[model samples]
Target: MRPTGVQPIPLASALGRIGLAGSGIRADLPLVSGITLDSRSVQHGDVYAALQGGTRHGADFAAAAVRSGAVAILTDEAGAELYAQAPAAAGSDVPVVVVPDPRRAVGPLAGVIFGTTDRDGAAPALFGVTGTNGKTTTTYFLDALLEALGRSTGLIGTIEIRAGREAIPSALTTPESPQVHSLLALMHERGIDAASMEVSSHALEFGRVDGVRFEVAGFTNLTQDHLDLHGTMEDYFAAKATLFTPERCRRAVVLVDDPWGRRLAAAAEVPVLRLRTEPADEGDDVADWTVADVEPSGLGHSFALVGVSGERLVLRCGLPGGFNVSNAALATIMVLASGVRLDELQHALDRHDPFTTEVPGRMQLVGEEPASIVDFAHNPDALERTLASVRRPGGRVISVFGATGQRDESKRAVMGAVGARLSDILIVTDDDPHDEDDAVIRRAVRQGAEAAVQEEELACEVLEIFPRGAAIDRAVARATPADTVIVAGRGHEVWQEVRGVDVPLDDRVELRAALTRYGFSVLSAPRIES
Candidate 1:
């Protein structure tokens, strides 16, 4: 639904544009400044949209919205009935416009209400990244590259929203439909010249990006995630595929790292530029962008970003893991594909890595002298890669991680096995055990870790600890001066989800406290800032 705002255009004019004017909408209905889905956030001259929610219809809150000064409402037939039936709304004069599906129209309607169209002047080139993982990191990379090119960048992702100089903590990987449009409009208002956003499968399938047109659409890689929401991997891929269509975006930069991506690149309707991370993916002529001459550095990996034109832009990657290298390369190619001048980016790089800027919680080194690292690697692929990347030169790898509750349970065992196989020590802990038995979750992970130790005939020690904080402490306390402690999952997040409530928890904070508890000195310079 819409959010609170000033009603600028006449409600009739907007409804007429969408051919909804005669459908119980008064021609002289109040002009709305903005739109909001939240009834609690309704303001004067606002159009509140009552949508079908998972638990309850938003129409149930229409009276409350009206009380908060909502002048009009857009809802489905069922919500309209409820609004009419409510005693408080029985005689309420607020005009209600009924539609078959409010979610699909919220973005478009919001665009009209907030003037997200060209009448306000051109909006910055919109770029977006979609994938199971790396969406946030890719957006960070894209925004940094854009800024280096002298563009006032706007970034919207899982961690935070950056509009010009303002940064706000994000509530969703992709915000609600109206919020997406409204935020873009606000970015335009703030004189942003370019924007990058992370598009989740849920956002694509749920109409969150309905009316938004991306200039450059990027795909990092697709993996098994949100199976409960999409029901199958094919369904998940299809939802992501929607973002690459000519209708949604004009140009596409797809990473052909996995089969899903290869398929997407082949099927995408727009002008496509495919990026490959494999140095041995033979037939270099088939790839548009390729990774070559990759080398492991002391802090991270460095690779040559080779474009189709046969020119290589080599840079050191400050972020860890091959996946990160792929993300960095994809970000560079995406920027260039967005029609950015290669010389500008090359000049911006000078000799530094695009990742010279800090990427919070993505291999964030919180302490040294028995190095402690915190990252947001929650899935099997991400966890495995992070552990492999942080393997000590002649030391051991200590991994502390857990599976998220109420998510793709199918991936839990795989994640456990990966951590167990890759790390010298695996400490299984809780990672957002929301509404699920924490013990059951822990047991499932330990079972997989133990199974991996048996099947692979590997010699990795595994431990299970209740509560995440104690797990962090135990992992760090057991490590020696030469060992590395890597805590995966929940990066840049200040809270942990437990039993439907958010408890204040930061992985970096916990890791640092654990290091202090182990008497580890801070005199050893932190390799990477959290």
Candidate 2:
């Protein structure tokens, strides 16, 4: 048995059940001390899980783990066999637990050791937001709102993981179960009152979020994404729905603007707060919250929020784009439903300033001569919406986008089509060609753009630039004062993943250099969309 707190029993019990060639191990045998998957992070008394990978097996590092003071090992049967054959020093005094499937057990074991599930129910309220595109935006908006209301909050998302003053670079959109619980425990200890997290479908399907409870769950509209991993839209939707199920969350706040969200709202077991932007149709049932008389202007949007009690509140947002209005409304309703006082909402809204700052890569504008916009729009729907938003009078739209390698190749053409139909000039370039040929991915995106232009009967010039930086620079140099440049895909990512390695790249820095080279001044005013 592992020492209490040094390693929790749930993880210990799972480890103990593995038939090792040993007698009754003491509950405090001091065999295991900690758990880790990253070999570099292995510490004394840690059990390093050696998982099988595309190129190598974790068992190959058993000696290294043992040298780092790991008392036991948890791996699959093959790994166990390999461990059994190792030299006496490598296998000496260390127990090897042979689990049939080690990956599935990583989360549960992590939960037992570092998780806070056994703590009193006084854990801070947690809210989970999941969707393909708007998850990061909504999470940030929620964090801002919570913080404005004088609540100490923690945030976990694709951008970064912020807990009080400590900010760790995010490794995944959602952390693995052990890290998740460990972070939650840290937050709880630091006097955090609430937490807002972006839950990815991959996290749900892989049990990365197991042993964590959510007080409220939010859903934004879903579009084409991650089909390569999920295999089908149905499977993707099922994975997203897992967040709202009884096992994951206790209450649900769903946006009914998308058909899938409407369906999920109907299927959720917990209390559902249905939100919609458009008017209810004749056959449409009443929703918990509805927006009406939406007024969008250059300044921002002002709308009326009607609740189930027929109570109305005049709300104004400092964010542009019609989609942002919907996002803010959904977040507002979610915060309200979480038991925050309605009176406090006015102060929160008064202090709410969406345009004062912007999400790094989303709708970031560079250069003044021929304005350049950088956004993270890879899918057809997101690309279409973003292009439409940048359309201005007396200005032509120049689009620069590309598809990622090893992802759903089917969407390449769709993105291309949207760009060709909306842009005056199209530049197809590399996004992330992880382990795949960059040229192959660029061609796919170009094909999609060409097809869209043909279908729409529009004549647009399409250019292919292999290296993204050169393409963006050429587009910027060629643009006149009356043109707008849009750089799509890979928003807020600090590194570009190519051939299985992450290369340092920042879109904002590159765009600035391109603008300076073209003798154009960057805009100083804040023009960010949430």
Candidate 3:
């Protein structure tokens, strides 16, 4: 027998279960206790999943994995061949389990090894949200809703992974196949009743979400993003549509606020519950679930979601933007779809200060005197919403934003034009140049903003501040108490990716420092009780 929670499966049994081409697989292999793709994280009695990657092959590290106590080498056919020919084969009795498509195989393999195939009542209910924007906030809202209902929830997204209350920093929006299964198993063991995950387009395309099944998969609006990976909007939409397939998720809630979302709904095989943000916009029948009467006041917004049944529910959110209203509405429908009692969700919303629902670095107010707001609005759509949502009272909106390097360069000019249209003072700063020429990226955005100002005859003052911290300083120093400073891009990220190095540079922390320099503090403001 294995340990308490770990139920080890015989290597032969698991291989036969997944129906992979087991050409060179040994019949009498050891019972594997765990599975891992990373060689450094391998342990005794674990199956080392060697994969063929874009940049490098996992077979190259088979020796390290074996040395780290990997019992068997589970890899693709090519990887298996490489492992057999390599020096690691010498004196190694480990069986090389060959599979044609190891990427897809890993998910099922992980599911069997971890005992998550039986995602029944005892298992935590899974919720997955995917889109170009609002996925993070939507996941956060669903997690918060469950937490308010007195249920411990695990959260998985770009910022971090939380197994109940345990927070582990994460790299990808959806972690690797093995890690995802392991995290789900851990969440199950920890007594979490539900989990909310942000599924990225890259994750879908790369098969990161292969093995798991979501109880309710949600879609935020898709816009111009991740073009570098998908190459085109159609490909990106196709990648996102895979999540809504009947094989992937049981139910889905789609916000048909954009054309891409409408396309997703039309082709989705699974039963989909639709939602519309600007339901009263007329002409186009968006969705029966209409979000109307949106009032953005005092760092939060409240809206009524009228479902297809003509039932109306009013909910408030701390986050700004019509985009966030869509996120909140989608999250609500997801909660209801997950079979949570609707009254419980309503009670949670009614009793709790919905504004107190904490989403870090997303329209996060570091200082309220001059009203400093930091958001992870990287793309053109997000920037448009963030700039539009933030109000300046009697003063003007001073927006500090920049485009990221090596990703969807087409959006840079559009972002520049939108930023120019929204802000009275626009500062184009550096945001994660990541080995690409920072000057070139900044010039593209700045030129677009400058040209837009000239073309549209806008009075916005545009400036190029290479370093982000200086941009924060300049924006803060120029703004008064009535003015609002909206910092877009790189919201919750702790470090700024520059030249392949993640330097410690958090926008919220830097923005706070800038606010302190200007003699403004959040603590100095009056607090409102929910």
Clashes per prediction? Answer: 12, 2, 0
User: How accurate locally is residue 318 in candidate 3, as Cα lDDT from 0 to 100?
Assistant: 71
Window of ten residues with lowest summed lDDT in model 1: 521-530
Q: What is the TM-score of each candidate against the true structure?
A: 0.95, 0.89, 0.95
Write the candidate numbers in order of decreasing lDDT.
3, 1, 2
Runs in model 3 deviating more than 4 A are 1-4, 21-24, 280-283, 523-530
Decoy 3 TM-score against native: 0.95
Q: What's the TM for model 2?
A: 0.89
lDDT of 3 by residue, 117-166 (tens): 66884358899999988888888888888887788899989878898777
Two-way lDDT contest, 1 vs 2, winner: 1
lDDT for 528 in candidate 3 is 18
For residue 510, what is the lDDT in candidate 2? 72
Which is better, 2 or 3, measured by TM-score? 3
lDDT on C-alpha atoms for all candidate structures: 0.83, 0.77, 0.84
Q: Which candidate is the best by lDDT?
A: 3
Worst 10 residues of 3 by lDDT: 521-530
